[model samples]
Target: MHIVVCMKQVPDSAQIRVHPVTNTIMRQGVPTIINPYDLFALEEAMRLRDRFGGEVTVLTMGPPMAEDSLRKALTFGADRAVLLTDRFFAGSDTLATSYALAGALAKIGEEFGKPSIVFTGKQTIDGDTAQVGPGIAKRLRLNQLTYVARIAELDLAAEEITVERRAEGGVQVLSTRLPVLVTMLEGTNEMRRGTLEDAFRAARTQVVTWSAADAGITDLTKCGLRGSPTIVKKVFAPSARAEKAHQIPTADLSFEALAEAVMGEIFARQPAIEGDLMRFSSGQ
Candidate 1:
């Protein structure tokens, strides 16, 4: 059961700033960390490998600096790492990102047998769109599982996997065949620290670096910004709100007074709210 986990190195949100002239995120001089969500996915894959007895591989697509993230994954016990970095891959939105990642996955499979499962973080902090994992599944034609909170069961021999997906209002427990892509939710488990031996091994390991052509991409038009449909025509920071909240002055922070003030405002603004309040007073 070989599992492939996709991870990304992202600029720390705290350190990120918008470039005044270009209207783009100013990534320079910002500390990078593994996308917070990706850490969960990596840990989950490692846990599954420990239980099912197989290898886990971590992959990332970013600037050359992202090699740091791949090496970190190795310290956590991934059997291999791959870096898909090239000038052409810059400014890629979800569609192009997915295409590039899928191509790298294919190359990894060719190098080390096919994987039984692919895992990814639910969403990247930098993108925050929660679309790439699904897009990758669509490109690869794998059964898609987003917001997977738990792996309920896995019958490797039977070629079936069951998982609990966190959905609005309820959980969806679905079963799908092998070779599925799962976007794992955060906080499932704590990330493990590498031992000295593991760290040494990771420092010595060479991550496979591939260009667009090396990954079997012959069509340049399908690999980067050209492949993306969504375009960011404008980027700007949110403007400050003009009006401030109305202050509720009170020497005594009494619950009844607070409730009365809130009700008064609601009733003044909305006649329907007054009627609802009356009905509530009369036990509906």
Candidate 2:
């Protein structure tokens, strides 16, 4: 069995800043880290590989500096790391990113072994659109399972996988065949620390670098800004709200009485809420 894990190097959200004049992200001095959500996917992939006995390859598309992120993944026990970097891939939105990544995945399959499963995070912190994973699935015609909370079962011989998917209402248990793309949810599992030996190996390992042409991307028009249709009108920090939160007192009050007091305060603040509650209780 072979697994492919998609990772991204993103600016640390805590340190992110918006350019005042340009209204764009100020990434010049910002520190970069692996997308936090992708760590869950990476950990899950490593766990699956450990249990099933297979090689896990980590792949990323970014600038030359992004190679640092791939090396970090290697320290976490990834068998291989592939970096896809090209001048044509800059300023790519979700659509262009998925296009380039899909092509790279096909190239990886041909050069390496064909992967049985592809894993990605629910979303990246910088671009929280959560569209790339599904986009890849659509382009490649692979079965997609998004927001997967857990892998319930894997039957390799039968070529089936069962997963617990997180839904708005409840968890959905889904079963799919091989060659599926999964977007793993955050907080599903904790990432393991790399051993000293693993760190040494990662330092010595050569990360395979590929440009757009090397990744078998034929159409230059479908790669970067030209392929990205989405337009960002403005990017700015939200202004501070005028109204502050009202604090409720609970001193010397019983739980039920405190609850009633809170409800009274809410009703006083918004009479429509009380009317709605009354109508709801009366089934109107």
Candidate 3:
């Protein structure tokens, strides 16, 4: 019952800034934190480990500084931390990242025990593409579950897992065998604070570091910028609107009158919306 949790170090979105001229993210002077979404996955992994009596390993791919995130995971009761860093992995899009990570996961399985489950966040704050998890699953040929809200049951002897998956309009209860990948949704569970003993142990533990070669990635063409097909042509902040928000007076208005006033204002601002609403009401 080994579990692998994927984590990422990301710039704090609240403090992120875009270069005025370049229109690119200004990472300089920006503080980094563990991806908030990943925390849910990590906590869930730890919970499963606690229940199943197995080791939880935290894995991340980034610059050398990403070891900080791995160490942070260790403080949260992760048994081990692995850092996959290499110069060839720079500027990798989701495709290339999934390739590198899948290779690393294979290496991890060989060096450590084969993991029964791999966990990741729903998405990263910086990228927010929500593709890496699925990409990794596709490359690894693992059954994947996305937007999982809860782990309902685990039958270790049967090697099966059941979870509540968030879906459009409702939730889906799914059951799958071992060797599966899951992208955990945010706000499923709160992250726990590390104990003083855990923090001390994390400070002393050495993180396992692996380069591209160490992770068994040989094809340089499929690693970094060369492997990334997606190109970012432009990234700029949205321009401020010229008009201010219209305020509706409600000093003596009843609920019905207030509703009417809001509707009138919306229709006034966008006449097409009123026509669309009329058409919708008429079953058009």
Candidate 4:
């Protein structure tokens, strides 16, 4: 029961800034952290490994700096970590990113034992596209379950898994066999703090770093920006609105008077809202 958890390192959204001239993200001075959503996936994977008695391997594709994220996963009790970094993988879009990740996964399977399940977050904060997980599953021809709320059961001998998937209307209970890819939803579980022993082990463990060639990626054309068809013509922040919030003074007013004043202000701003409230009160 080998489980593979895929994660990414992204700039802290609170500290991210846009370049004024270039209209691009300013990564030079921004601090980086593991994608917040991916922490849920990592926690789920670790939980599964703990219950089923197996090794969990964390994998990522990014610049050399991404090694920090992998080591962090090791501290959370992952058995191993793999980093896929290469110059050819620069400026990769979701398609190219998924292609590279799928190729690396193939190599990981060959080097270690084949993973029964591959897990990832629903989306990345940087891209916010939520496409890479499904893309990887498509390229690898694996059954994909996205937005999974909970894993109900796993039968190792039977090689089957059951999960409760979140949908637009409600939750859907689905069952699938092994060798599947799952994108976990946020809030599934909380990430655990590393013990002193685990922290020491992570500090000494060497991360397995691989180039594109090492991951068995044969086609260079399908790797980086060249393989990406989507082009960003511009990136800029939206302008702030000119309107300022109006405050109501309640110090001198009674509770009823304050309520009336608040309602008057609301009606003044949007007259149609009063009519809607009246119709609802009348049960129209």
Where does candidate 1 stray beyond 4 Å? 19-23, 245-278, 281-284
lDDT: worst 10-residue window of model 4: 231-240
Error of 3 at 66 (Å): 0.9
By TM-score, the best candidate is 4
Q: Global lDDT of each model?
A: 0.89, 0.93, 0.93, 0.93
User: Between candidates 1 and 4, which one is better according to lDDT?
Assistant: 4
| Pairs in steric clash, model 4 | none
Query: What's the number of clashes in each of the models?
Result: 0, 0, 0, 0
Position 105, candidate 1: lDDT: 91
Residue pairs with clashing backbones, model 3: none
Q: lDDT by residue for model 2 over 86-134, one digit each (tens)?
A: 9999989999999999999999999998888899999999889899999
Q: Which ten residues in a row have the lowest lDDT in candidate 3?
A: 231-240
Q: 1 or 2, which is superior by TM-score?
A: 1
Q: Assess the local accuracy of residue 28 in candidate 3 as a C-alpha lDDT between 0 and 100.
A: 92
